[model samples]
Structures are given as structure tokens and as C-alpha cells.
Target: MLLLTAVACLLNTVVAAGGLQSCLHTRLSPASTLVSPSSAEYPNATVSNNLSWQYFASAVVFVGSAEDAAIAVKCAAASKIPVTPRGGRHSYASFGSGGRNGSFVVDVTRLQSFSYDPKTTYATVGAGFRLGNLALALDAHGRATPHGTCTFVGIGGHATCGGYGLTSRLWGLLVDQIVRVTAVTAAGDVVEASPSKHSDLLWAISGAAPSFAVVLSFTIRTYPQPASTSYFDFDFGNFSDTPSLAVKALLAFQSFAATSAPPELGTQFTVGRSAGGTLGLRLSGVYYGVETAIPTVIQPLLDAIPFSPISNTSKLQGYMASVAFLGGDDPVNTTGRVESPNTAYEKSIIVPTSAPLSEETWTKFVEFAFNTPVPPGISSYYWQIDAFGGSYRGKRTAMAAFPSDANAFGGRDGLLLMQHGTYSDTSGSYPAGGHAFANSFAGTITETVRTEGKKIEAYQCYVDPLLSADEAHALYFGHEKTHKLKALKHKWDPARVFDYPHAF
Candidate 1:
């Protein structure tokens, strides 16, 4: 039949390309679909958000189920080829695409399925489901889960790697909401990890998942839709002209967030080039309450700013509509949620409240950002500082399955999470133009923060491929936690089947 012929052709192609006939015949399942490097689907499967990462996998397996995933792993292990799981293909460093040549990649987007229980308020989600689709599904049931703003990101990767979002302060992180996880181990066994069963596995995957297993699904806690949601957008003018004022305003906001901001309020401060070519600062956020409460919570920061905002907009709407407003999308159709791939580099650092943002540091940031040359329409850059440590403080005790103190994530106790990013289009005249600028900007920021304060740390979720092995280990997981994760890796994936850059 046609299926049989296609399988025959695929087997021949694999043998010709990878030269793993014995392992393929012994371990690969007939139902598992393999896309050879010469196939047209290969390009699509290999495309990633960060185009800078050039991944050349021996084969890309379109896994249809958890069993298929296990088969792919077994085949890769038997063949002595490294294997990595790919969901949304959005890893900043292409960690999802095997991360090295001659490796095998298992793409799990075909495993999309989810169910929500109204009585128990728990949602079981497939690993391959994107955040946007999940949001639409949850909205139909009048429920919501704390997830990142980018709807196209896969939950499998995001949830396991510390899912930070607008409502993080109100409901805690997405990983913290996970009650159970189902994953395929390196030994080709499907295991369910939770608080009581596979407790250590659960703790390890809550943040450092890539080094342990290929997560297939998750059972997460959900919350009822908020009665009303409010949003505010404030443009605080160009930072180049008013460096001192901009830095003062930013520090004031951070100070307030550390001491006064309620759990229901979440804010993000950004410094980037406006559409008109001016470097400016913007403050935008959401309040999970009535419109009347927005002013009371945000007034202090607004009053602290030395200059009046150029533009201010506030609205009270439905929960979904509020999400759209925060994400700058069309409320009714969500048309703004489109994805256009490009080459980019990013780095992050966590600043604790004890080591506040100093004026000298802000001046240096302003100088570097303004001085950086961005190719007119081909490249761009930005610096973002997300408020971190409010309700997150309760995770130490609230999340019994994966306590904040012992997990691999490093930003739980930090006051602000700072991210520096530079992006360039591959089709541009100078494809690699953004690298030098991004490196300089990121290095300056990291050096400034570390020199100014001793308590600063880096976020693991923003995995920077440039980090050394020792630096990555120390930044992603501290000395003690790294050792614990390594021991768990030894027990679960002794052969190191699930490995990538910066992996445990």
C-alpha cells in the first residue's frame, strides 16, 4: 500500500543519510515518521526563533504520541546519536533542535490535546500546545492559567523552564502551578512525575527540564476568570535626552514594586527605539481588578517621574481583551499574534532589592543603548526590566512539589529580571551585523551589574549559548543545586540522551 511504500523509501533514505541501519531496524517504530535532511519538510522543521543557531540534525522525527517519542529516543540511544525534543521551536539558542550536528530531533507538535476539569479546576495540557491556542481553549471554559505573553511559545518548554507572565505576581509562575508532569525518560519509559511519585524528577523538571527528560504533558492548576481586568500604557519620552530623569523614574518604580505594589498588579519597564527612531522608555502592565483600583496602585510611580508621559491610555475590559491589550493585539481577532522568524541574541540578569539600580549604572546603560548602531530597517534592540519578587515570595512555602529555594531557577528572590536583546533579519544585506552590538550591550550590562552589586544573578530560562560550561552551571543552578541536578541526570538519563547547550 502507499504507506508501506513511503516507509520503505524513508528507511532507505535514513540508511543512506545517517548510516544507522542496524539501530533503525532494531529500535524505530513503523508508525514513526522520519523526515530526511533532503526532504522539503526538513527546512521547516529546522527553522527556529533565533536564526543564529545553525542546527544540522541527522533526522527529524515527527512524533505522534508519547510512545513514538520513546521509540525515537531508543533509536537515538541505540545508534549513539544525541536526541533533543522540539515543541514550538522557539528556544532563543535553538536548544530544542538538538543543539548539535549528527543529533536526532523529535518534534512533538502533533501531540496537541488538552482537557479542563471544572469541578477540580485542573487542566491537563499537551506539551506541544502553544500558549495562544491554550488561552483560547481556557477562555471558552471561563478559566485561565499563568503563562507567558508570547502565545506562539510551546507550553512544554515554557512551563518546565520558569513561565513568567503578566499575572505571575497574582497566581505565581506557570511551573509553580504544575501539579503533575508526564515525560519519556532516556530509557524509553513513560513516567508520571508529581509530588508523591517521582518527587525528585518533578523538582528537577520544574526548572531544569532539558537535562532530564522529554516532557509530554502537564497537569496544572487553573483559576477562574477575573471579574474585570485593567491596563495602562505610559510612554516616558526618549532616554537619550533625559538619562538622569529616566533612571530616577525607573529606580523609583522598582523601589515601589519591591515595597508597595500589590500581588494583583504586574508591570514591565522597557527602553527601546521607537518607530520614529528615538530611544524611549515605556511602562505597561495589567491590574487583575476593577478599573477604579488602577490609579491608586500606579499613582506613586507616575508622581515620581520627573517628566510627564507623552501618551497615556487606560481601559477596563474582559479578561481576554485585557490580555490582548497587554500584548498589543487586536482584541476581537488577535491578528497581532503573528510570528516572523529572525536572527537574534539575548542575555538576562537578576537584580535583588538589596542591590538597587544606581544612577551611575543607568547612565552607562543609556550611553551604550544610544550609541549602538542599528541598521535602519534590518535590525533592532531593547532592554527590558520585569518586576519579579512580590507574590513570588510565597512560592517558598506554597509550592510543595517544587519549592523556590531548591529549584534550578535563579530569579525567585530577585526584585527585577533584566533582559537585553538585539535582532536582525537573515535576508538583510548584513546578516551578522547585530552580533557585535548585542555582545557589547549585553557584556556592558552584565559587567556593570556584577561590579556594582554582589547579589546579582542570571536567569536560566534565557539560556545564552555564549556562556561557558562552568558559568552556565553556576548561573542556571547554583553549586549545590547543580550537583543535585547532575545526580538526578545520572539516575534518569545516564547516557545523556537528552542533552543540549547549557544543559545539566
Candidate 2:
């Protein structure tokens, strides 16, 4: 009779276990719809910018509101399952969807909503609003906020990660424009962060966003549209034979940017392999003043070059039109091309004004661009150098909202940001060798910068997946600030619930 009772008790335990599994697999919150792997929405929810890092989630919580997001976090905590919040899904390192083995992804793209207060000159923006839609909305009000060039990138990631755009020099980083942010904490509490409230989280989210909390919305200070804007494009064809002249011209431009270029001017220099395997350099930017001022600012760069540019074009247009023009899109309407999913690897570094540009480093960069073997469907790899010292220069010390001492962004002290990128088509599987070569080339460039140019820091937004947590912390936050970030992290998320590659 005892043996019979033991068997019956064992059966009852199994039945209870199965019932608990059924309950856990179903909806966890009234505000969120939990979609299992069997649901068709699972595929779309798991998509990321880089196909190489695509992952399947155990379940996706389609959060309808910030309250729903809070509930979802609580559910994940109860189940002891990891959770990641996804916005536009544009993380090159796949921080949004990758590396979360069987984790729950809270899709916040459904929370896109915005409101502008004309009197206060502040716009309350939903975290899920894409840059293009936000741009249009602000343009309707004759106001604008500084943002990144890519249109499809979500405001949450961009602003939190230190957004930069054509007007960033004149204004400030997207984070600088933010007056307030609302986020859901790891403790499953909805909190508002700003200079006055939950201030530590506010400082951390300004740059190291993914490591802190799930941002729900931001209140950003907006500026009135510029009266007139002008743009100039200069193309310097194959510099293989006359590389010296190109170098001289580049240095001259850099000098002008550091010493002469006004806050209203923004410039980007690109060096890459053009069609037919020829090396080329292109300089492009916009001036916030009238068309007449273009000559005064750009003439010094023109004079430095020994040879004339193959093409030079300048035009006057509205602020939004200039944005479209700079993005290589239609000027009448400020809409950028929707970037399709493709394989890409990027490395970015901050070049301080003190770092001297050596001939060896320049030659090495040129040779790598020309000699790197492109894959079957790949077109070309490129480098972009953006000027940063302008009105932004003062914000490093003057901005009280995000005190310079506590801010996590590492590029504020640099004169320019140099980005190296490798591109591959999405039509076929990404070649393993191609990615390897790109990483090698990027490492070579970084080493050269450190050994020759004496610049050891890198931009945090261009997150590299291969970096060790320690190395990434130093690169992104510097030694002093990294310690502060760690203390804050321990205070808010002691369990390290929100994590990814290079996360704080």
C-alpha cells in the first residue's frame, strides 16, 4: 500500500509540472501579447540589422505602452529569463536581437507617438519614432532636433548613444538636446530621468544607453529652422600618383576645420575605392548661413589642393532640403533612402587635435583601401572623417544637464571622428573570409592610429563586438568615467539583467 501511494504522488508531481509549463508559455501580461515561436510574428520580431547575428527568441512581447513594458520586465524577472528592448533594430553589433539565447525581446516599435509644445520649444518624442518620421514631424512645426544621418534609426538608440548629424556642430549631440527621458527600470518600475530626477540614469543613458534601462520617451529641446542653408560637394579623382597633394589638401582642410570653420559649418571627408578600382576622395558638407558665405569658408580648402576638383557644386536651399541633399536623396523632400539589410563591419576612433597625422599612417590607409579584396557581391569599402570641434566644443564644459565629468561620450575632446567601414551585399550568404579580412584591416588601422598618431580612444556609438568588456569600457567611457558607470550600474541593476556585448 505504501508503494502504491508513492507512485500516485509521483504522477501528481508530473501533472503539476506540465500545468506550470503551460502557464509560463502563455501570455504573461494583460498589456502585452506574448507570441511564441510558433506564431508568424516571431520571425519579424527576431530580425536585426546584421543577418549574421539574427537569433530566435523564446517569446516576443509586443508591448503596447510603457506600462506594458514594465509588466513584461517583471514577467521576465519572475521567470528568470533575460530580456532586451528593441526599437528600430539597427544595432550593427546586433545588440538588440543577438546574444540573447532564448531571451524575451520587448518590441517597443509600437509605441511611436510624439507631441510638440510650441511655447516651450520642446518636443516629447516616443522612443520608437524613426529619424525620418521625427524629422518630418518637427519640420511641420518649423523646428528641428539634432539627429544622426540614417533615417530609419530609432530615436531611442540614436539619442541615447550620442546622436550626430549635419547640424550637430551648430547645435549639439541628440542627447544634449534632451531635457527629459522616461524609462522602465530593471526593477520593473517606470521612472523619469533628467537633471533633476533619477539623474544618474540620465547621465548614463546619454551615451551608454543599452547598459542602463529601457528608454520609453524623450523630451528634446528643438531649434527654429535656419533661414537659409547651402551645401558644397568636391570630388577629387584618383590620387594614386598625386597622393602627396591629396594629403596636403586633407591636412589643410583639417586645419581649417579646427581653427576657422564656424559652428554653422559641418564637413565630412571620405576616402574610398571608386568604380574600376581607383582611389578617390570626396568632401561634402553644409553651411547654415546663406549661399554667399560658402566661398569664404571653402576657399582655403580649395587653395590648398594643387589640382582642381573634378567637380564642384553649390546650391542654396531650405534646412530640410539641405539634409536630403547631404544624404544623397531628393532635395524637394527630405527623405533618405531606406537602407536594406546588408552585411557590414565598422571601426571608429576619435582623433584628438594633439595627434599628428603621419605620412606612414596616411599611406597605410590608402594602400589598405586599394588592396583589400572585395567579395563576389561586394562593391567597396570606405572611410569617413567627420569634423567635430564647433559649438559642441563648448558643451564639453558648459552643459550642465549632462555634466562633462559624468558624461559617458568619449568623443567630446577629439577634433574629428574617423570611421572605417566594409560593405557586402545581402543577396548571398556573407563570406566568412570577407568578414575576417575586414576585421583585420580595421585592427591594422586602429593600431596605426595608436602607434603613429598617438590617439588611443574610440567612439562608443560604433560598438565593436570583438572588444573585451574591459577594453570596450576603456574605449567608450575612459578610465575615470567607467568606474562611475559601474557604480551606477550596480546601484540600479545589481543582477546585470540588461546585458550585451560591451555592455557596462
Candidate 3:
């Protein structure tokens, strides 16, 4: 709430209101929630997760339906201002605000319509619903979908941008479950995209939708409720105290995940220091079967770390309960804050099989993580490493978006995805070397992996704010996919009407 107020003060700068209001009034419903810079809701409309990206949008439109979204797009195009569809407003670089000032913001929070068809077992939901709300809706019918832990992240961006959840290894990504979608193209025309229809558009949208289209709703293929899980966790004491021991021990865990780990197992290890200055490691996961298997499943990791765990925790719970726990929230409270303002910079490392770290590189990575000199004003930092690509990479089927080729999610081959970052003490005050600190850590791993004679990549969801547009395009999509996206971009948005910073 304080950050929201601070953001309001920072963005209260008055700017000229270009003729977007008149154009929108002609097409949008009279009762539509539209706010310009002069409106009281302007501050609320402009707030976001990452305070580092505080660009002012020319106008914010809380669209009602697909038709209304199209109208907003038409207005932005007519006014010659870039239009960006903001779902959760969680874009690390704030591309949701067009990533620049004076852009038109199409706020999708009002399109909260949802319906589940038990006959097809498919759920049709508007893009506005947050992840928690969508989860509750699905759980009502004894059904669920694979998605990330963040309760407040919007379904629109999360689904399209390769969503990974704790059960992703068993099921698949949110994009993998997308049977079809309704979207507004750059030309202000609405269309549907699925495997069987407008597939190229579907492929272009699934990985990087903002570049080509503004999605209105998604019709997803749903799965039945999964079996209860045995939650397993072991905490290794302070990292700075025993870096060589803990880091080396953790490598064995990664080895097991890449090879012998079962599809029913999912895990992530977080490396961060506590407020008491205790740099520690917490390796936690859930086994989606009997509790008996949990011991055998985690024995290798336990053996690797010779020292006794400072704390060990294991519990059996339903899927939703596990979700709330993993997200650091209580069982009853699922829908978290829609906007969480913070000063942070994150960089991702997508470890492909072709470029896995060797023993030598792994040791070097440990050295860097433990001994590297952090830049100034870096109040706190951490890294989250998730085991990816069990069923995620291997699962292939006739289901619409199941096959690797069905959509544009490019990191299928990655064995592990590491999202690491540093944050500032104050809400909007960025640390002096936040980007450099984050980049150096990610860069060390990336360079070391490349030196081992293979390829390494990054996850687009944890966007790097410092990279150039070209660098981001190459890192996220590589040459071939970037070429494909650009071709589609030209076809659908030749005028670049819906352009934003680092969109493609």
C-alpha cells in the first residue's frame, strides 16, 4: 500500500492527453472503466510489481469483452500510440505499460468471465483472472491445471509465457494445456488460435504473445485432480559458512533430477540469506503419490549432503494446499495482492541438455556464487532453481498443444531453470549495482556452460531488464524462432501498432 502511494506520487506528472479518449468513446461501451492521466484512478492504473519500470501510459482501458478490447486497439492505432495488454502488470521491465511513456495501456482486469464445460472437460476463462482465482475455479469441479506458485500473477501472461508449476513435471506447462485462445490482432480484428486453426498465430502467441496479439481469453484442456503429495524439505545451514560442502552436495541433486528422478517428483532449491545474515539453502519438493516413496525419492540428496539437516519437514497434503504452502501463504488465503511493488532485477539461466555444466564448471559456479564480490547498495539477493523437463520435455501426444512443435515455448529442452535476482531496501529506490550484481552471477554460469562446448539459454518469463532488444530476442528465442516470430510480426503488425520494448 505504501509502494502504491509512492508510485502515485512519482507518476503524478501531467502529460498531454492525446485524442485517444474521443476515439475510444466512439467504440467502447459508455460504462467502460477508462482512466486518463487526469483521472483519480490514474495512479492505481499505473502501479506495477517492478517499480524500476515506472513509465506513464497515455491511457488505461479496463476492457469488458473481446469486442471492447478490439475497440481499444483500434483507438490506439488511430492515435499512433503503442498499445500494450497488461494482465497482472508483473512484467519485470514493465512492457505491460508499453515499456515506455505515452503508450496506451489496455488493462485486461475487467474481462473476468469464466465457464467450465464438464462434457469436454475444457475450461474457458477470460484472461483477466489471477492464478489463484483460476485455481479455485478449477478445483471446484475436482479439476486443476499446471501453473506457477504466484497467486496474484494473471493467467494471460503466465499461460502464454511457458508457465511452470510444482506439478509441471507430471502434467505440463500452462501453455501446453492451452487448447485454444481468442485474441485481438494488431489490426483490431479478433480471431481464434488453436492447433487445428490459425496454428501459426498460436505458435507465435504461446511463447511471446505481446509481440503479435492481445489475448482476450483462453480455452484450456483441463486435467483431473492429482493424488495427494508428500511434501519433502531439508534445510542446509548458512551458505557462506560451508559453501564448498553445500554447493557440491547440491550438484548430486541436479544429477538425479536430470536422469533417474521419476516424473511424479517435482523440486526446487532456493539459495538466499535470512534477515539474521544467515546465508542458507532450502531444498524442497513434493512427490505426488504415496508418502512411502518420499524417503527413497530424496535419499540421494540427503546422502550428498553429509552434514545433518538443520531442519527437516515433510507433510502430506492435497494439491491446492501444497500450492499455498509453496507460495509462502496460509491454506485459506490464496488470492494474494494484484500488484506488489518492489525494486528488483532478475536474470534467468535455462540449462539445456546440450549445455549442462561439467564437474569443473560446476565447481567454478560454486566459487562464483560463494565468493564473488557483490556490488554496492545490494541489500539482499537469492536464486531459485527449479527442476524442469521430466514429462515437460518428453510428453508428446495428439492433444492440441501437447507436442513440442504445437506452440512457441522454446525452453522445452532445458533440464533446470534458474531464476535469480537482487532487491533494494526501499520500494522504488534501485540499488546502485543491482543489474550488474544479477547479471554477473547469471553471466558466470552462462559463460561457464558455453565454455563446456555447448549451448545455454534463458527463460523469457524472468526477463532481463538490462539486455538490449536484440540480445533478449537471441537469448529467449534464438535465431530460428526469432526469425519465425518476426515473420509473423510483419504479417500481423506491419505498422508495429502494438509494439513495446523488447516485445519480440
Q: Positional deviation of 470 in candidate 3, in angstroms?
A: 1.5
The weakest ten consecutive residues by lDDT in model 3 span 392-401
Off by over 4 Å in 3: 1-17, 274-276, 330-339, 390-402
Tens-place lDDT digits, model 1, residues 180-292: 98998889888999889998998898888888888889899999889998888898776577767776877787777677677777788888873247887888888889899
lDDT by residue for model 2 (177-255), tens: 8778899988989999988999888888878777778888989999999999988888987777776676676677667
Q: How close is candidate 3 to the true structure, as a TM-score?
A: 0.92
- Report lDDT (Cα) of residue 391, candidate 1: 34
Sorted on TM-score, best first, the list reads 3, 1, 2
- Model 1 Cα displacement at 201 (Å)? 1.0
Better of 1 and 3 by lDDT: 3
Please name the candidate that would achieve the greatest TM-score relative to the true structure: 3
lDDT of each: 0.75, 0.73, 0.78
Ranking by lDDT: 3, 1, 2
lDDT of residue 207 for candidate 1: 86
Q: Which of the predicted structures, 1 or 2, would earn the higher lDDT when compared with the native? A: 1
RMSD of each: 5.9, 6.0, 5.1
